[model samples]
Target: MACKCGGYYYTLNVKASFDRDLNKRRKFLLRNVSVIRMFTSGFFRSKWRSIAGKRRILRLKALTVSLKALKLAGVHGIGIEVWWGIVERFSPFDYDWSLYEELFKLVSDSGLKLHVALSFHSNIHSNNGKGALSLPLWILEIGDVNKDIYYRDQHGFSNNDYLTLGVDHIPLLSGRTALQCYEDFMLSFVNKFESFIGSVIEEISIGLGPSGELRYPAHPFGDGRWKFPGIGEFQCYDKMDDLKMAACREGKPQWGDKGPQNAGCYNSVPSGVPFFEEGKENFLSDYGRFFLEWYSGRLICHADAILAKAAKILKKYQEREQTSVMLVAKIGGIYWWYQTLSHPAELTAGYYNTALRDGYDPVVSVLSRHGAALHIP
Candidate 1:
């Protein structure tokens, strides 16, 4: 069958043998199989089925050839990354969905389910050595790069980091918070592809942070640059972070006006110190716990902002179209867990095998409250 969308047409072909093979496997397993063996087989079979489904989704960019291949492999779903930069590259509220419309039509014609990943940052390598920004260049031009808008690394370098569209700056258009602008983008996205929401596009994975993973830029400084000390240093020391710290220290005059840095509270050593000494008073204090929670709370706020906007959009669509569409939030795993410099337990009391030593519960709590699925990849 051929599907047409905005001056483009594609044909879809499904191989019949794939369906036959799936049925054959199912029947073979059910025929006089032992209960334990049947259960084990079923569990592994489901896992393989999910893996195949995701593989098919990830190959959606290949178009007709991919659809045919996925069908032959007994895969029924496909995922595609929709670049925010490309979609709204020209200007705010000005979008071109020609490419996506074509892809959706192809998926619909192929009778396959779809998952859409909304990517706001790019890890694409360019000639400039700075990773490509998934945000529109014009948006970056409006923000103050010198401020805490962009992420900085352990060495206080901000060269290679991608600018976060919703967090790092004010919206290009007036009278809108960054969160509201992001929500408006989601609404526009759903409106543009409204016809396919409940049909072909079964899920929308919202990109809450860099590389579509929900966490701070753990290694934002990039690889082989600054080696981490005995304990991983938090990189969110920009003006905005400093402001947040100031707020945390408002009632507590004992911590001083500068928060952790005021009293050499970070890593149990004074600022500019490279390493922490064992059995130091600052090291044994609850400073690490307070910092962990403070940093984690900041991350959770960002995650909440994005997820809340996404939930609002999904709810609007559900009510308007009378169909359910799933929302998925991608959570990044512990980026510093495997560091060879120091064991996480030895470095700080609150450290763990999670992002920035901040546990995943805070992020997960927001996702659960917003009715979004947690995707840890």
Candidate 2:
């Protein structure tokens, strides 16, 4: 069985807890980092599906027992995904934490700590096309009208999985920027959960990009356009024309509207791939240099803006509570074609990292300022 969220799958492999001495010493600055693992559970799937349009926690007693069992078995805690779609699903700024409140209370009573993630992405359907959780309806409605708000490839195909980095600061979300929407979600959470911050909550993971990780959906599945070993298409552009191109298209009309064309397929031999080939005059060309830089720069700006907002909000809570409420940001792993000059997969995933250029440095430098730990999921 697979745990699916926002068109991605995760395997639970947590094998340890946050160091007890570190927790006790409050030496968060010592910065001995541990990976913050999370679980979504079956609760989300069945919670909203009660009859008569009602939402209920099915088998409350059983859930209570399970939490107690985990506590007694020496489990550390659980990661509760406070979904943007569910909380503010109906309209802007109207957050509903009803189900999460109950779950959190149960975990608290069971004496387990919490690793909370503000999941700002959607969950796609199963193979049977039954699952339905996704971005907020209001946001999706706007995307329906202005397709440029979401990320798409050169083929004019786009996804509403998560809003694209193209429109992070764009005032398209009913007069609110996408970054504002995310910040508001965090502000509401901090204000709502004051009672649990230092006591039960260990860390707050802020989702910065797709699948709750800070990266473009470069090699997205179910689109039939990508698969393993493929170079993956650039997701910086949208399906719309004449709109502010997501990656910007001014003064470079000669570069044309399309992205790198001869790039390798989802599964291609490194030898025959023209775009990624050495001295191929495609990826190393002036146009490739320009587009890749602009594409990746947009992503970095998105991350920088969001982290600045998040650090400001969450750091205050840490000061008031006199506890270390760490902020975590996740970036996807892009290791394909590392041996090549282009590093096609990395470039498409909002990383300009390659033999010719150092990309992660700039992104990590931004993270260091906000005291955020980056997790590669």
Candidate 3:
């Protein structure tokens, strides 16, 4: 029988322990790389030259990095995180590519693929990393200037503005409606880096919450210091209709309707309950359920959306450069765990188990299982 979070009918082969065999593992990986290079080089040469070449190079780098990182850590698998705040904050206009460029290269060089966590909050953009994790500054700005559509508060104590997820105007930060900004962001990120990281980085992790929901307990004011910008007005499911309408007007599909729908908001035990009423255990149980539904329901949808984007962009890059490596989504991280800082191991494992029972695949195994078939786009 398949494990709960083990989504597929097939088992992804991963070594249970690193002490099994050193030289044998190296030999196996080497053979895999050689085969991948040969196959990608042949297929991607004529039609998708650029994308194919880039994918191949990326694939090689990703393999090298994953292998190296595991060796350094002395483990067969290591956790990798992609700070979303870092990527999205550096938007296309004012973004700094060098930091990521260098870091990704290091990862590739290290032979470690990242089990990335794409963040939605950015302290740099808010100029308040000290406060509650705020919406990326770009998004706040968009909601601020474009129209008075966001849930806004003028009182100095709590000036946080909340925007309903599906109803808000185009994402101020993304300049597109609701979830459209997220999709575009994914496309742009993949397209820009496909030449570098696409094919090589096989597994990734993503996070999602109540539509435009950034963080729970929208802490706008506490003990005279504001934690988040839009606390009092934090809008969530109340605005789905607006988001769908906006998407229709913009000629985009209304994915919001088809995506996972999180009902009751849950708070975390250690993270301090929102409204200062719901106790920690209550928060955990309720929020856990909320996350369970949201993640499981949208697992395939989210995976398919990102995979499609990656495929499109990879195909383009392969046509141009003919590299071999593929970026794939394995499992998503639980945002609820973000507030619980003490025992990441326990929290991550708990959520991992939860996802397994709910029918999502554990990320590490996905790569190992599909290791052979995965190659340049």
Best by lDDT: 2
Candidates 1 and 3 compared by TM-score, better number: 1
- Cα error, residue 140 of model 3, in Å, equals 1.9
What is the per-residue lDDT of model 1 for residues 215-312, given as tens digits with 9 covering 90 to 100? 65543333433234323344454444543444457554354223234222223222333223233323324654455455556667777778877887
Q: Can you tell me which runs of candidate 3 are displaced by over 4 Å?
A: 1-70, 76-80, 88-92, 121-135, 144-174, 178-180, 198-200, 210-237, 240-307, 314-377
Q: Candidates' lDDT values, in order? A: 0.50, 0.69, 0.35
Q: TM-scores for all candidates?
A: 0.66, 0.82, 0.40
Off by over 4 Å in 1: 1-62, 125-133, 143-147, 159-176, 221-232, 242-278, 281-284, 316-323, 335-358
TM-score of structure candidate 1: 0.66
lDDT of 3 by residue, 247-362 (tens): 36445544334212221122223333332123443313444434333423333333344345444544544344544443333232233333332222122122223212322222
Among residues 3 or more apart in sequence or in different chains, the pairs in candidate 2 whose N, CA or C atoms overlap within 3 Å are 230-266
Task: Write down the lDDT that model 3 would get.
Answer: 0.35
Clashes of each: 2, 1, 65
Best-to-worst order by TM-score is: 2, 1, 3
Give the Cα error of residue 160 in candidate 2, in Å.
Answer: 1.0
Candidate 2 Cα errors over 4 Å, as ranges: 1-54, 125-132, 239-253, 265-269, 320-322
Tens-digit lDDT track for model 2 on 182-266?
A: 9899899989898898788877778888778788888776556677888777774574323345335556665656667776555
Between 2 and 3, whose TM-score is larger? 2
